[model samples]
Target: MLLAIDCGNTNTVFSIWDGTRFLATWRTSTEHQRTADQYYVWLSTLMEFLGIKAEITDVIVSSTVPRVVFNLRVLADRYFNTRAMVVGKPDCELPVDVRVDLGTNVGPDRLVNTVAGFDLYGGDLIVVDFGTATTFDVVAADGAYEGGVIAPGVNLSLEALHQAAAALPHVDITKPQRVVGTNTVACMQSGIFWGYVGLVREICARIKAERDRPMRIISTGGLAPLFQQAEDLFDDWREDLTMHGLTVIHRYNTHKDFRQ
Candidate 1:
């Protein structure tokens, strides 16, 4: 079985893949302080409950947090007796050509999303990841990583609002009944929800104008469903796009036939 781990800023996602099918998936809070043994204990307990063995043949990891990546590497080596194939490293082969400025560490999650988006729906694609920071990644028609936009995520924006102002309260990011809100909470919701939708549409339109051919927009990450509710801005929603990309990259690296 292949174990795929996507460690983001706010959450860490795990998925077990038995050859072609996904066996089980789970999400947990991103704790940077957790030790290798602690991670092993937690993962072992979860696997035991799910009736899965601790013997993971292959481990693939894509982490935005550098500290978590180091810890995950330790956990994989110490507990599973396997070395993880970490994305964003020199060894991993990205299917798409990255034309960004040299020395810039493109977030592993973003790169993974790009690879998956391009592989699934060819090039001239835009991947909007609604995570801690909502990022838009644009891929050219020939599968080159052309840069996109980044904006505050819905949750982060709300958090900032609450932190910046004492009177403002943190509200759950749900589309309110009306855009024009009477109450404070409702007003915050309207801004966070519809405002993000407008951001998505505007950025997507700008990216589309740059390309000659029609581009496909794919939305991923935890909060994709929230944005989907407001507008038909995205062509597809891939909840497990990052994990799937890790799996694809893992296969490409491990199997000689997949190497270009």
Candidate 2:
């Protein structure tokens, strides 16, 4: 079995893959200060709940948070007894040709999303990830990571609204029944929900114009389903795109003809 870990800014997702199928998956809050032993205990409990054995053969990690990466590396080595193949490392080989600045460290999650999107939808694709930050990754016609925009995520925006304003209250993200709201909660919802939709459409349109081709828009991350419900911005939705990409990369690294 392969253990795939995606450590993001807000949440960390863990999945156990038994070669061709994902055996189990779980999510936890991103705690950078957590020790390896603590992580091991929590993970073991999760695995027990899911009935997954602790005999994982390989581990793959993609982390956006540097602090969490250090702890995850420690956890994998100490608990799993395996040195994880961390994405964005010099030794790892990604399928896409990254055309960005040489020293720029693109988030592994974004790279994985791009690879999965391009592989599934060919070139000229935009992957919109709505996580800690709303990331727009543009894959060129030749399957190269050309880079894109990054905006404050829905949750982050809500947090900021509460923090910056003295009276505004933090509210859960949901589509407003009407665009024009009559109450405080509805007003906030309308602004956030419709504002995000407009942002998605405009950014996607701009990216498509720059590419000058028919591009497939793919959306993932926690807020994808909610936002997607209100608009037709995304051409497709893959909830576990990053996990699948990690599995793909794991296979590619272990076997030379993995793509075949």
Candidate 3:
């Protein structure tokens, strides 16, 4: 079995892949200070409760938060007794091409998403990920990554608004009853919700026009379903896209015969 760990800015997810299919997945907040023992305890307890008996032999990690990598590496080495293959590291070997300016270090999460999107959906595509920072990644027909856009995430935007303004409270993002809000919370929710719908629509439109080609839009991340439900923004939404990518990358590294 392979242990795929995707550590994002806000949360970290663990999925157990048994070659043909995934068996279990768990999520927790990302904390750089968490130790290897703590990880084992939590994971073992959950696995025991779920009656999962598969042994984790290989570990693959895709981490946006670099600080958390060290402890995760320790977790794999100390507990699983295997070295963890981290995305973006030279030896990890990706199955896609990354086209960007020289000396530019693209985020591993974006790269993983690009690879996963191209593998699942064929050609010219725009992958919108709503993580700690909502990002737009453009993928070429040949599975190459072309840079796109980055905007403040809905939660981040709301936090900024609350902090920057006096009298405005931190409001959760939700679809408003109507465009025009009758209360302060409703107004904030409308701005965060409709504002993002417009942001995603406009950005995708501009990207498609600039590329001058038809591109399929794929939405991923926790907030993807929310926006996708509100409007006709994305063609598809895969909540576990990153986890799936980690599995693909792991297969490529171990087998060295990745099919597309």
Candidate 4:
């Protein structure tokens, strides 16, 4: 079985893959202080409830928060007795070529997303990831990782509104019935939701115009579905796209004849 861990800035997800398919997945808030015992306890209890049992023989990890990777590494080594494959390291062996300036390090999550997006769509693609920061990455038709844009995430915007403004309260994002809001909550929702729709559409349009190619737009992350409902900017949404990428990279590295 393969234990795949994707550690983001806000959340860390763990899943077990039993060679053929994913057995189960669980998510929790990312904490740098979490120990090997803490991970083992939480995962064992959760997997026991779901009736998925396995001896974790292999492990793979992709992390946006570099600080938490230490705990993840310790957990993998101590509990599973395996050294996890850490993405973004020089020897990680990604399937895509990243075209970036020297000394600039691309985020592991972005690279994983590009690899998965290129594998599925054959490049000329745009991947919008809605995490702590909204990232837009462009993959060329030939699987080159061209850089893209970054926007403030929806949740961050809400929090900023509450913190900076005196009267505004931090509210959940939702699609409002109309563009014009009748109340404070409605106004906040409309601004956040509709504003993102416009932002996504405009950025995609500009990217397409600049590249002059028919690039497929792929949206992922927690807030993707919510924004997708209000706009047709994205061609597809895969909730487990990052997980699929991790699995693919793991297989490629572990198996000599992975293609077969």
Candidate 5:
């Protein structure tokens, strides 16, 4: 079994992969100070409740927050008896190429998403991930990550709006009843929902124009489905794209001949 950890800014997810398919997945708030013992206890409790008896032999991690990697590494080493393969580290060989400017350190999550997107959907793709920050990652025909854009996430934008204005209250993102909202909450929701729809449409259009090729757009992360429901913003919505990528990278590293 493989323990794949995806550590984002807001959350950390653990997925159990038993070679052929994923057995179970668990998510928790990201905390850098969590210890190995704490992690094992929490994980053990969850597995026990779910009745999933998985012996995590191999571990792969993709962490956006660098601070949490240490505890995760310790968890794999001390508890699982294997060194965790951390993405962006030299030791963890990526199956695909990352084409970016000189000295530009690409985010590990973006790299993982690129690999997963290429493996699942093939090349000439754009993966729009709605994480702490909404990111657009362009993938070349041969699965090379050619840099893309980044923008404020929906939740981040909402938080900022509330913090900046005294009158504005913090609100959740949802599809507005109409383009024009009748109330304060509805108005905020309208701006966020419709604004993102336009943003996605425009960004994808410009990216396609710049690339001058037929490309498919893939949306991932928690908020993807919500946005997709409002409009055809993405060709596909993959909730487990990052987790799937970790499994693919693990396989590639373990077996040299492993292909997408």
Candidate 6:
């Protein structure tokens, strides 16, 4: 079985993938302070509960937080006896060309999304990921990763508003019943929800205008379904897009036939 770990700013997801299918998946908070031993204990306990005893022969990781990579590497080596293929490292092989400025450190998660997007749907495309920061990544028709936009995520924006203002409290983001909110909570919800809809549409429009071609938009992340329902912008929403991409990259790297 292959272990695929995707570490985001807020959370880290671990999944076991057999050659043909995903067996079990787990999610945990991404903490840089944790040690390899600690990770092993937690993972083993989870496996015990689930009755999963598959041996992990290979591992692939896509981490947004670089600090967490060290711990993840330690976990792979100490417990699994494998050196994980950490994306964004010089040694990690990618399936797509990244067309960006020199010395630009593109996040591994974004690149993985691009690779998966290209593999699933070929063409001029934009991936809107609702992560810690809502990112817009452009994938060219030939699968080259073009530069893109990054804007404040809804939760970040809401937190900033609440932190800066004494009267405002941190809001639980949800789908608003109406755009014209009457209560303070309702008003905040409207702004956070509908506001993102407008932001996504405007950026997508600009990208389409600049590219001057038909565009396909894909949405991913935990909050994708929430916003995707508010607007008709996203062509597809795959919650496990990152896992799909990681699996592809792993096969490409480990299998000589795939690499060729």
Per-residue CA lDDT of candidate 3, range 35-112, in tens? 999999999999999999979999999998999999999999999999999999999988888899999989999999
Q: Clashing pairs in model 4?
A: none
- lDDT for each residue of candidate 6 in 1-260, tens digit (9 for 90 to 100): 89999998988999999988888889999999989899889999999998998899888989998898998898999899999899988778888899999999998989999988888888589999998899999999988899899999878999998999998888989999999989989999999999999999999999999999999999898898998887787999988888888998898888747731
Cα lDDT over the full model 1: 0.85
lDDT of 2 at 124: 86
Kindly list the per-residue Cα lDDT of model 5 for residues 1-260, writing each as its tens digit. Answer: 99999999999999999988999999999999999999999999999999999988999999999999999999999999999999999989999998898999999999999999999999999999999999999999999999999999999988988999999999999988898989988999898888988998999999999999999999999999999987888999999999999998999999988777
Off by over 4 Å in 5: none
Comparing 4 with 6 on lDDT, the higher-scoring candidate is 6
Q: Compared with the true structure, what per-residue lDDT tens digits does model 2 show for residues 1-260? A: 89999989999999989888888888999989998898889889887887777578788999998777788888878877888899999777888789888789898999988888877788888999999999999988877889999999999998898899988898999988999999888888889899999999999998888778899889899889998887788899989989988988888888967662
Off by over 4 Å in 3: none
Which runs of model 2 end up more than 4 angstroms from their true locations?
A: none
The TM-scores of all predictions, comma-separated, are 0.96, 0.96, 0.98, 0.96, 0.98, 0.97
In candidate 6, stretches whose alpha carbon ends up further than 4 angstroms from where it belongs are none
Instruction: Please give the distance, in angstroms, between residue 120's alpha carbon in candidate 2 and its true position after superposition.
Output: 2.4
Candidate 4 residue lDDT tens string, 19-66: 777889899999988888899899989978888878999889999888
Candidate 6, position 242, lDDT: 86
The number of the candidate with the highest lDDT is 5
**Each model's C-alpha lDDT?**
0.85, 0.88, 0.93, 0.88, 0.94, 0.90
Using lDDT as the measure, name the better of candidate 3 and candidate 4: 3
Query: What clash count goes with each model?
Result: 0, 0, 0, 0, 0, 0
Candidate 4 backbone overlaps, count: 0
